[model samples]
Target chain A: MNTERLTEPSKDELASGLRRLGAMDPGPDFAARVMGRIGTAAPLPAPKRRMARVIGWLMEPRTIRVSPLGSLAAAACLLLALGLFLKINPGAESGRTPAGLSPVTFVLAAPSAREVAVIGSFNGWKAAGWTMRNDPATGLWTLTTALPPGSHEYVFLVDGTTPVTDAAAALNVDDGFGSRNSVLLVKNGDGTAL
Target chain B: MDKPDNDRDDAMAVERTLSGEREAFAVLVRRYQGPVYRLMLRFSRDEHEACEMAQDAFVRAYERLASYDQRRRFFTWLYTLALNLARDRARRVAREPLYRQDLDMTLADPGRDPLASLEAARLLDALRDLSPKYAEALALRYIEDMPLDAVAETLGVSMSGAKMRVHRALHMLRELYGKEGKQ
Candidate 1:
């Protein structure tokens, strides 16, 4: 391989060489194979417009005809039955871990913050239920909760107003608003990150 | 035909396909299949994988047709999708040993000099050593013979950015080839 002398090839030579490299034939049946695969695959579902969804919801028939005393009695019975069920299944009442959910600790260090919450695709970007607790000693807010094993994009809300990304996150994606959101990849029960 | 005419034809095809004529997409497939396959082949260096990726790219284009902006050229959009797919495939097969296709066998001219063929192969090998962005920029510019503006459009960069990428890529290629020569 005596390619030493040919190291500094002219620009035209490089262009011609690249042109040669890119000239492979893709064979005759290429289009046919692609069309065949398309025929076998399922067609994409029609996208529903917002107006259609609203119309569908509005058109759905509902019946509500109950006496006030009967409604109150039914509500009371439902509450008593829920209390009995909770008494029997204490773990369910205590919010026991669902199957296939791995515990992931979300930490944000905001010393001066009054409140901090983690919001992401997993929780519909809701800050109400996924609030973090602050540690007086380290001033680091932490929340350890079970998230389904997958990649999740999250942002930390400081004091219920400011949105901040976790600096410790390994991956980040644009939030489409000139800001970035951190990404967390939770491994499965077998310790495999997907 | 002129470039604008080609772009108009592509836009018309997209309009027809979006209007429920699925066969209109075939027009697009036929028009771009060669260049898309060539781009994928440059990335994977495997004929079979390139074909699969090209087909997959067309299928994806059809599926995501609604998302396609009519203002852009169809081939540029399609080429970008194919490039991303090829990059993903390359990443998955990164650990596998690379099998370089023999460039000499596919030449149309039998009387071509063997030494030139060897040199071409060495240049391609040096190209493979460059980063994907740089190599892709160079390939789209030189191999596909795309204009700087088209290259910029395909790469989602400004014309000046595309020019810078090509310059940097060529510089890297020169360094790589020079080092290989010394070895």
Candidate 2:
């Protein structure tokens, strides 16, 4: 650390001098030049209607109808059909993965951690809604979540602040912000990782 | 207009500009052109480049006007945009030598007091030597005479972080100025 000497200007003097340094005259034509360019330049495009606003409006319920028994029956049939389909056509089940999604299990041994979450390109780098559950006895935190297939970079956020990369991951990439993120290649369920 | 009216007027200009009144943007440009150009000059250290960068900043602000949060001070957003532009320009021109012997010849006015000019030049040189973060904080807090909260908003830092940067920058500047005086 560089220490200030007694001979140096006091902070107040420096501040006052800086303030008095004043704005440089950008010339008499500055504003006119700016206005001219703005006049000639293309106008801003109108903003696109946001999908989130539409979704929010759609999510508001106007009414509710109860059909518990019928809904339960339909749900049971759907589950049975899904199970049979998975059993009979394992390859098809994997191929049918929704929009390149695949199940992945992330495990971390953190004895001191109270809470952990996963953040990555898959979740738009957000730390919410992807929390991991911890086993108190083994002191192991685990998260099983579906991620889009292909190379996805992620980090384990510990206690909502510390970003820890997985040591077990053989692949890692620089996040371009002075941090490394663990890279995971989700397979297409064809026994080959992308 | 008084200070509060001027601020409210700036916001009103933004609203008008966004509502297809293209001429209203000129009001904002005129209002802020001085500080914006000066801020750029602090980073670029060249008057022409500063002018161009200030123009670029205003153009960008106009293009991204819809994203501006009206609750915040308009200059904060504009200053932040100009600083980012300056940083990008600095990075792109990092390989090139910034200081030129002829700079004084081109910039200095013969009629002006030589002593004041020399002092200003020395001050600018010292500022250039400081870290970019420190330079930016000092420029915003002192040169622009922004309130601490406004400085924090412009730099995307906390109020305390802004304060620390200003304090550290002043200390660094003092030390650098002293060393220069010795020579």
Candidate 3:
């Protein structure tokens, strides 16, 4: 029972009993029964004769909504693919990495930033020797780091001051500074697992 | 448990179900069956009909998943859809619901007070006879234990409108109940 209620029902047995009635369950196997007959009838929008149309709409392709961040991420993936095509490995991607390391690429769309650095647990959280290159052609900041197969925490330092976490990160945690830090898991022998 | 959390999970389920994962729709059916079934019982106290109506509601929702507005709470949209189905079924099928029989069976317990059950039954009878709008307001507010904003959302009305409907319904129910007392 919630002690701090936002609204009060009538203070009477009828209302109280009605509240108690809310506990009633629909009974077991209810979900199983519903699932057994979902596809029997066509939707009101689609008549039976238009089965091919339904299949066409169901199989329709969708496009990504382009945004600044989205464009930067796409550019990063393209750049990574190109790097792989040419077998290009920017050496010393990060300060320290274990044996059998993979180069991981990170990107941020900070067009106005004068400088950007990659700071994370990988390089002792310091913004030294981990500077990301700025692509003036696209205004996207990017860095490729070679790391072994393991989990890592990282954040982008825009203009060497403010920290920005990747919005598309699979997981993130509180940075204890009223902000978030992104987590990245490097897959098997893949460089720039952005 | 929180509204935002439920909304996020439901949005994901809706997305997955839309993207050819038929099993994701089952997760939604399992999550909301109890509430949908209870609401159906308000329209027809028969357990079998309530279950059927609930199943129909989920199927209809699955068919219309594309039309669901992401702005509204998924449960609110589902409850409103179920309510509309119940109303549509009532109009199509002319049959009196077995309210008293189901109530007796529900309230029959060894340690339960017989008098309390009788009063509950009488109140439910008045509830059934009440106008559909008022009856629905009471059911959503009390039986569903929904907050005022959620009740408003489910009823497709404003906050004051929900409050007015609930209070008026309560007043009508009390008068009808007093008549039951006299009899």
- Stretches of candidate 3 exceeding 4 Å from the true structure: A1-11, A39-194, B95-102, B106-120
Tell me which residue pairs clash in candidate 1: none
Tens-digit lDDT string for candidate 3 (A4-117): 122222337558867766765677788888878876443334243478879887898988689999999999999999778556545443444566987677888888889999
Model 2 misplaced regions, further than 4 Å: A1-7, A40-42, A46-194, B1-3, B95-111
The true-versus-predicted C-alpha distance at residue B156 of model 2, in Å, is 3.4
Predicted candidate 2 versus true structure: per-residue lDDT over B1-183, tens digit per residue: 665787799999999888888889988988898888887777775777778989989888988888887888898788778878888888988623345453464247676666665666667777878888998899888888888987888788999999999999998999888887776
Give the RMSD in angstroms, all C-alphas superposed, for model 3: 20.2
**Separate DockQ for every predicted complex:** 0.25, 0.31, 0.23
Q: What would you estimate as the lDDT of candidate 3? A: 0.78
- Best by the lDDT measure: 2
Provide the lowest-lDDT 10-residue window in model 1 chain B.
B99-108
Model 1 lDDT tens row, A47-163: 667999899989999897999999999999999999999867543554766679876778889999998999999999999888898998999998867778889999999988899
Residue B85's lDDT within candidate 2 is 87
lDDT-wise, the better of 1 and 2 is: 2
By DockQ, the better pick of 1 and 2 is 2
